[model samples]
Target: MATTTEADIHITKGHEVLKLYQFNTHTARHYFCSVCGIYTHHQRRSNPQEYGFNVACLEDVDPFELGEVPLGDGVNHPADRN
Candidate 1:
């Protein structure tokens, strides 16, 4: 995952570079690079106010250097419950 602050994220250069996809509930959107097919980021379903991005897309940053990333239980997302 990419380390991002909500206000810091923006698609500065490649406005048309990525393709978008969403499935089932259509609550989240996944973006991928059209040329390289790299998963770039997603409009998170759990928190539409934020985005989840791929660390690989970040320039000059190594995800391993961040240490101990936490995982979330998307399968049991609270929003899905009544």
Candidate 2:
């Protein structure tokens, strides 16, 4: 996942490339590339200030090289408890 501030993400190429999908609580939004059908990023419900992005969409970056990716407990997410 790419850790970046909301302002850092610039859509230089595909301005209309993403399609949004909302599920469950509907607080978070999942964005997919409309052309290739690839998951690009999502607005985090837990932390609305941040965005969770797919590292594969980044230029010249390999996810395997990042090392030790931590998984979030989505099944027990605090938002779902209510």
Candidate 3:
């Protein structure tokens, strides 16, 4: 996932077809393409100031090229602890 600040993300197009999904406390906002149901990005619950986007969604970007990607621990979400 590639990250950007909340102020930096600008959806120039296809904003109409984006579907939002929220879970638990509903603090996080996850967006997906309404047509094909592919994940687009999400406003992070852990860090509301940032948005995490699916890097695979971008054109000509190979995940393999970005070796040893770091992973987050989702099972122990901060919201759940709170």
Candidate 4:
């Protein structure tokens, strides 16, 4: 069981939550809640400061789910912000 908490979630911008991957950076390559087939958020390689969110989309997230916040940065983040 890959249970995660608010501390597990990376960042939140507005109403969107940021999720991350330890190895993968491709936003679409990661999967969320395979058991429930839910897609939360995805790892972002460009702005490693936070994960990219699928705002119009989400699933299986409880009402009390951690509100999205900001992430300082990630390990090996791209130097250029372009």
Candidate No. with top lDDT: 3
Which ranges of candidate 4 are over 4 A from the true structure?
1-29, 54-82
Q: Residue 77's C-alpha lDDT in candidate 2?
A: 58
For model 4, residues 1-82, the per-residue Cα lDDT tens digits are 1223334564343223323335543532343543444565654444444454434343465534556744446564445556
Q: Per-residue lDDT of 1-82 in model 2, one digit per residue for the tens?
A: 7656677766666758789999988988889998999988888887766887889788899988988888777677555666
Candidates by lDDT, descending order: 3, 2, 1, 4
Q: Residues 1-82, candidate 3, lDDT per residue (tens digit)?
A: 8999999988867899999999988998999999999999999988899999988877789988999998879687545665
Every candidate's lDDT: 0.79, 0.81, 0.90, 0.44
Q: Is candidate 2 or candidate 4 better by TM-score?
A: 2
lDDT agreement of model 3 with the native = 0.90
Write candidate 1's Cα lDDT for 1-82 as tens digits: 6545568789865659899999987988899989989888888877676887988677888888888988777587656678
How high is each candidate's TM-score?
0.72, 0.74, 0.77, 0.30
What RMSD does model 3 have?
A: 2.5
Model 3, runs deviating above 4 Å = 72-82
Error of 3 at 68 (Å): 1.9
RMSD of each: 3.0, 2.6, 2.5, 11.3
Judged by TM-score relative to the true structure, which candidate is superior, 2 or 3?
3
